[model samples]
Target: MDHVQHLIDLLRDDLTAGRYRVDLVDGLWGDAAAAALFRGQTEPAVRALDAGRASGTPSTPVESFARLFLLGQALPIGEVAAAFPRLRVAGAEELGLVVPAGGDAGRMRAALDLRPYSFVDTLGAGSWWVVSDLGEAVLGRALDKDHVLGIGGASTTLSGLMIPTPVDSVLDLGTGCGIQAMHASRHARRVVATDISQRALDIARLNARLNGIESIEFRHGSLFEPVAGERFDRIVSNPPFVITPRVDGVPLYEYRDGGLVGDALVERVVREAADHLTPGGIAQLLGNWEYRAAPPGSEEGGSDGLERVRSWVESGGAELDAWVVERERQDAPSYAETWIRDGGTRPGTPEFAALYGAWLDDFDARGVREVGFGYVLLRRPAEGARATASAAPTPAMARYERVAEAVGSNPAGLGAHLEACLAGHDWQAHRDDDALLASTLVYASDVTEERHYWPGHDDPVVMTLRQGGGFARTAPLDTALAAFVGACDGDLSVRALCAALAEVLGVDESLLVADLLPAVRALVSDAFLLPAG
Candidate 1:
């Protein structure tokens, strides 16, 4: 224990002194090369690295580490020692980070993928060293069923969506590599991270300790089994929610596939999250919901995946507030192919064909037409909400929508936007129409109005209101509503703006206010406009 602890300290010092950072790496290899590497092609980056070195030997610390770690290339022990003088080659071997090359006893190769990850979130800029299993590129074969994955696109998505509000405790349900738990620790006083796979728990613990974050506590068990009776102030998870077929010859990778058929894993997480949260606590997660056909001769018709998620919240309890955004949907073939390739299975192979057939057969048996992938943010209603100005507060939010816009990187993520929107929802939900009319609103800074005209006409034939953040939503607007939105400069109350528009359009003031009030409330809920400061 002491040896590993001492080695961890030495490793941290070496990483810091070597300037191992995402941006620094970009500077080293250029953006084009870095992007090519992300797409599973390392040639461009390898070319750049080869050009920088003389006689195939790394000349710098970051370059040496990148060659041995990220590029999965063997380096001489002398180069490894020079790269990390504090934690030399022997220390790295003792820490199980590197092993002597089989072909050449004098060379060392990375036993793990240790790289610097940098992000700018709700809590400013931060960087950390993440350690996880080597990828298929390094392993040169399909991943083992229990292989622990490193950072990927899903990791980036969940980390960006984490709310950075201060809380007493957070429960990270499936702490794969402990990424979300580390992100949670930035805001929470303490965090409990749980995973079903012991290997995953081991990697997560090493990752948390490597980053010098002490607030995270690691536990081993499946789903909520690790922390059943306790409640937390916040919960975040990127669970093994992938829908995989339960059949012979199908690989069940612990990192992606839960031991369930179809999308039941995500359903279980959504249904049980509220029971594990305190009052007003929020749960943020990514999920896949299936669009299944209704049975023959049934009164209820088939529904989209978003509606299915809505049913999960309703069945769970009334105290839960849910905002589900379906970002993408895929048909059976596309979804099957995606996950198949993810496990390093190449196309036109027998194994790929067998797995793909199994997936389609499973979907067919379940009557699933398509699958939806998106974010699910749920909140437990606080009892104090009724004590505010209104005699009866509105029920918890159960809104669902589909968002398809390309994400913007302004604040790097939507946590701040989500936080603001929740606050805006609470502010407007307690107010009746009259109260809402008296309140002032201003369009968010990222908002813009788009006008389309017909061949140089005097007026626009079509109009739209677009938001640059918080799901990157865009709404079609008629002339009157566009005028109302344009007039929202935080100067006058909604009542005054509606009345003025009504007078100019020669319509009934009451009718205009009635028509505009619903749109106003929706805008507030979706965060197109905000309550005046």
Candidate 2:
């Protein structure tokens, strides 16, 4: 522990003094090299680093650190020593971050992946030095079963989706390198991060200390075992939800595969999360579901993937509000190919072929035709908010849809937008038609209307209300609805607007009010229209 603390202090000082960061490293290599690095091709970045060295120009500590760690290249012991001056090569060896190169006492190579990760959140921008097990690119072979992963695309996605609303406590289940937990610590008063792998916990602990963040409590267990009988105000997980076949000789990656058959791990997480959340608490996660073809003699062919997720929520023993979005879908073969390639198996190779076959056989046994990947948000109702068993009452809020479209320019952040959308849903839920008609609304600034008309016609044949941000939703509008939306400046009540539109269109006011009420409610729920004073 003493040695680890010393190493952490040295690393913090080195990174701070050297100014090792994303922008500086990118500027050092130029755009093309940075793009190549992003695509997992390190040759361009290596060449650029070598060029800087060969020019006989003195290298900055930032450049030396990037080459030795970020690029996974060896450097002379003397150069590393100069970059670290404080920790020195001896201290680095003690930290197990580097080892002497073969037959050369003057050179050293990294034993782990240490890189600078930067991001912007509700708190503003910050960077941290994250350490994890070396990846396939650095190892030049398949990863060990217990390998821990550093920040990746999935990590960023889940982090970005995390709602930034202040909370008392948060649970980061399946915390890998502690990325999610660290993000949660920014808003929550306390955070608990758990992982099934001890190695992951070790690295995550190292990361928390390295960043000077101490509010996160690390626990060792799978899923919710560590937090049994406890509840949190918010829960975030990017679990090992990869659907891997349970067969011989198929390597199960600790970072991705949870050793479950066909998306069961994700289902289990969904079902169990209810017990660990406070009333009105939110659980956000990313998952993949199998869309099986309907069984023989069934009214519908295989089960719908999104509906399966809905069933999981319903079986949770709690009346949970669910908002599920299926962002992308892939057929069986394509899904198999993608995951197989992800495991460091190259296509057109014997090993790849065998693993691909295993995936297909597994899918065939399950009758799976396609796989859908998406984000899920589940919220437990507040006290007395749940429906009673005596009545077959409708859920106040439940949305399950396929929003595969791109989100527009989201300057305010997606997490904030989603939180607001949920609040909007709840606000509209308790209002009946009469109450809705009595309300006034203002159009969201991000929303605009588009019209297409015949060549010379003044009136548009088609009218669409499009949101510039927040899911980039667009709703087709009819003549009366379009006019009503245009007049929603919060100055006129919904009832007044309907009355005026009816008079202008030469129609009965009562009928017009009835026709536009449902659409008005939908608009309000979706944030296209907002409640006004």
Candidate 3:
């Protein structure tokens, strides 16, 4: 055991010696080539490396490793071994990172995909090596159903959205390559990462070990089954919630499809999350929810996606705070094409046509008009959860929004923004309308106002308060609300501000206060306005 541990430590040291970092990798092949390589186009990077070799530019250890693992190029054992002096070809073989090339003597091919990933979060900048199954681009064929995925857009989105508030323990369900579990370990004392695939668990464990992260414990089980009857301070999952048809000829990619017909897996995760969370614990996830075709003569609009998610949270019958944001919704056909192509079945192929037809047919059978994708933040209510049994329980927080435009950038990442918003919400939740009116509040620094005048009119046609960070929310403000927000400098109480605004606008103070209270609470939840310290 000690020898195996020492072997992995050597692998880590060798990778560090190779200068495996985002900046160095980008510098190796130039920006355009790097961009192309990330898009699964290897030609540009291959040409760059070939051109460099022709120009007498010696390959660095990172370039050699990238060529072998990332580009999936089979190189002479001598060349690959030279890059890792400590963990040479023999040691790499022992670690199962490489294998002898079939029928090609003295050469080896990568058995997996390993790459350097870097990010900036609340804990500052960090980097790590991620190992996963070889992609279709490397295999030159369709991916296997149980393929493990490397760091990608969804992975980065979830990690960036993870709140870094210090926690005792966290549960990372469906922890594919252990990306979220690794990130969770930064702020969490321990993390239990569970996945249905043993292969995924093995890879996740390798990732944790490769990064020198000791706090994560990888387990093999589907969803909450691994830690049944146990609870944690936090839970994070980017589950296989893809909407896949169960019919014949339609492929079920294990990395995306959870085998439970259309969004049922997402529903299950949301509902079951309640039982696995300790009091005050929060579960963050990314999921897809179907937007069903509304019933005839329905008064509600076309989309019921947000409401369905709310119902899932309520179905758990727990007092939980749920803030779900629908980042974007894709129509049925678009959604079908996106996932179909994701499995490496290109358009114009017979396989692609068949799968696409199956997806649409499945959607039609269930009356699914479109699919909504976004972030879900659910918190098992704090304070021993219903500790106020003797008193009236506070209403659980539920805020749903559909944000279609690009969200603003935050240096410390969205996690801090979300944490602050949730904190602000908690502070204001304890205060009633009467108490809220008596308290002081300050607007966030990322907020600004914009006024648009039509035809050079003295009165503005539209006034808007825009949040530069958080979710990049733009709140259209009426004259009274605009004045109210402008006066929120933490100087005066809410009552004083409302009175001052009413006096200026010639409106009754009582009505003004009543109208602005809800909007003020809204701004607080959006991190536009925060409780004054």
Candidate 4:
């Protein structure tokens, strides 16, 4: 038996013998530590190694101990796969290792695509390899592994950020593990998750049951074809928006890679989303877009990442609202090497270097410099705005909107700014369902409310209480502002009450309409607010 197989067997024996029950397994390495390791960091590995060395198990083989400790416990196959690194042996050979029968590389991948974090774990791999394991783990008899689904933060983030207004229908585009579909099932009357991989769809169905969520329809196909002519009140996707080439003969994972070159996956997804949305419906997604960097401003003024997204929203002849939050931008070679590491394809190997070089060459040919990747939230606007198209779609809108600049590198301040703005506007606390019914609301405490008005405007709009240091302040509101603010009892809205207040406040409502509205809409666009359509 090989060294790795022995270790695998020993762990299996330990699991079967009830040495580590499912609940206790997490105690060994907490989820955060396990998650860090699974995402390919050396800190946890080094710490675990030192801990093993200190435990008087010198030469007990640190890697073996780590694997043993990890696998011996009854962790789901998917989570285990993610924590498995690119190293050989890993002590799996210390005992007789039984290859789950008929398991090829795809099946062996269970150690990789075990959960939602698998996407980030494998994001460095330019090839789509982890999806197969996701299928096996999610569908495996463990939790009725009916669907091999790769679960991770992106999946959950997309799920959590979806506009949940109890819509009649929801469509999960590129539904890898069906996480989005499962979440949508909570509010939408009917839900469907689609992917090109039949394996993924199978796992999506299994996951639906595993999570005790029912009535989700799973379909096998690419993008919109599976749900042609199907319009939905909400559409959510954590699609294969990674701009990478689709390797042939490789069963596409359908979770992260869209099988296209450079930003096309996102463009296509955005282009097509309008067709699937009910009028005024919203589609929220996470996407990576390549922003072309030019000379001079290359370091400072790289094309705003949000512009391309705006173009996509407007292309469909839909009046639209788009919010693009650029999280990280990596250079071509750095990006290439990063993805290679993700695929478990070592950088030292000649073949791996060649593949990476090809990726760089592809970028150079396209005149692409740094790649911009982030979340995209788009809404189909109600009809009748001037049909004029701008030269630059995103930044122009962002500038015209007059949102406070992203403060510092953190952007944490951005949320605070948005909160203060909402708090300052007409904030009506609704007692019942009457839109016109006004009730006297006394401040239970002083409310230091803030309103986000056009940068130059004088009206206090969005109303949020700032309760700190044991002091409370109540900020007052106008009639229009009152109607807007009073409507926000965790429900959805078609238009922001603040925009109406801008009209009533008689501040350049047009500028307020253009600049502040997008930012206000962005809060809803990011799923931070109840659907206030």
On a 0 to 1 TM-score scale, where does candidate 3 land against the true structure? Answer: 0.94
TM-score of each: 0.95, 0.95, 0.94, 0.56
lDDT of 3 at 331: 96
> lDDT tens digits, residues 419-504, model 2?
76876676667666777788899999999999999999998999999998778899999999999999999998998899899999
Global local distance difference test of model 2? 0.87
Model 3 lDDT tens row, 420-504: 8898787667767878888998888999999999895899999999888877889999999888888888999999999888899
Q: List the residue pairs that clash in candidate 3.
A: none
**Candidate 3 vs candidate 4, lDDT winner:** 3
The 0-to-1 C-alpha lDDT of every candidate, in the order given, reads 0.88, 0.87, 0.88, 0.51
* Candidate 4 per-residue lDDT over residues 151-205, each given as its tens digit: 5556645654555456798888887767667667767889988888886776566
Give the per-residue lDDT digits (tens) of candidate 1, residues 1-533. Answer: 67777888899999989988887777778989988888877778888888877556537788887888888999889889998899988899988889999989999999999989988887689989999998887777898899888999888899888887899999998888889999999999999999999988888888887889999999999999999899999999999989999998899999999999888899999999988999899999999999988877788887779988998998986568888988899998899999999999998999999999999999888888899999999998886774446576567787798877577556669888888889888888889998999989999999988888899698888889888777777888987899988889999999999989999999999988888888888898878989997
Runs of candidate 4 with Cα error greater than 4 angstroms are 1-24, 30-36, 41-149, 245-254, 293-304, 382-533
Query: C-alpha displacement of 283 in model 1, angstroms?
Result: 0.5
